[model samples]
Target: TQLLEQSPQFLSIQEGENLTVYCNSSSVFSSLQWYRQEPGEGPVLLVTVVTGGEVKKLKRLTFQFGDARKDSSLHITAAQPGDTGLYLCAGADGNKLVFGAGTILRVKS
Candidate 1:
């Protein structure tokens, strides 16, 4: 079985702060996907990294997949209050998925 572990269960910051979140596992997966969800809405796909050591960017956010395909990270630059949401990391192996507990981020203005 594969499991994803996320760190810094919660984060609170003022506007324009930068934050980095981490997801880790001991087993390798075929691909990794990141999602960000807001209140009253389902998670929306942020990015998917399939290759080891791959990096993807979305505006002010950066995502990286580990060299061993067992870990990933999300970095946000100059975060805004509108960035408040829950961030999740998921591992895809074949058709199955292993999800992390999640990281809740709150940016105050």
Candidate 2:
């Protein structure tokens, strides 16, 4: 069985602050995808880190996949109001999918 867990189920921040969210698991994953979803809208693919120990950066956001392929991290630099939303981490094993508990980020301006 594969499962993903995220820390600090929720987060609220003032505009311009920074934050980090974590995802962990015991089972190794083939690939992992990170998504940010806004209210009333489907999640948008923020990034995907497939290689172990690989890191990808998108503007103020940075993502890293664990060397063991069982963990991941997201770092937001200078968070703004536009960054507020639900962040979801997903692990894919062939056609099956497992998701983290989810993190709700609120950025107040």
Clashes of each: 0, 0
**Model 2 lDDT per residue over 18-107, tens place:** 999999999999999999999999889889889999999999999999999999999999999999999999999897778887999999
lDDT of 1 at 20: 98
Q: Residue by residue across 14-75, what tens digits does model 1's lDDT show? A: 99989999999999999999999998999999999999999999999999999999999999
Model 2 earns a TM-score of 0.96
Off by over 4 Å in 2: none
RMSD per candidate (Å) reads 0.7, 0.8
lDDT of the structure predicted as candidate 1: 0.95
Off by over 4 Å in 1: none
Model 1 / residue 101 / CA error / Å: 0.7
The most accurate candidate by lDDT is: 1
For each candidate, the alpha-carbon lDDT, in order, equals 0.95, 0.93
* Clash number for candidate 1: 0
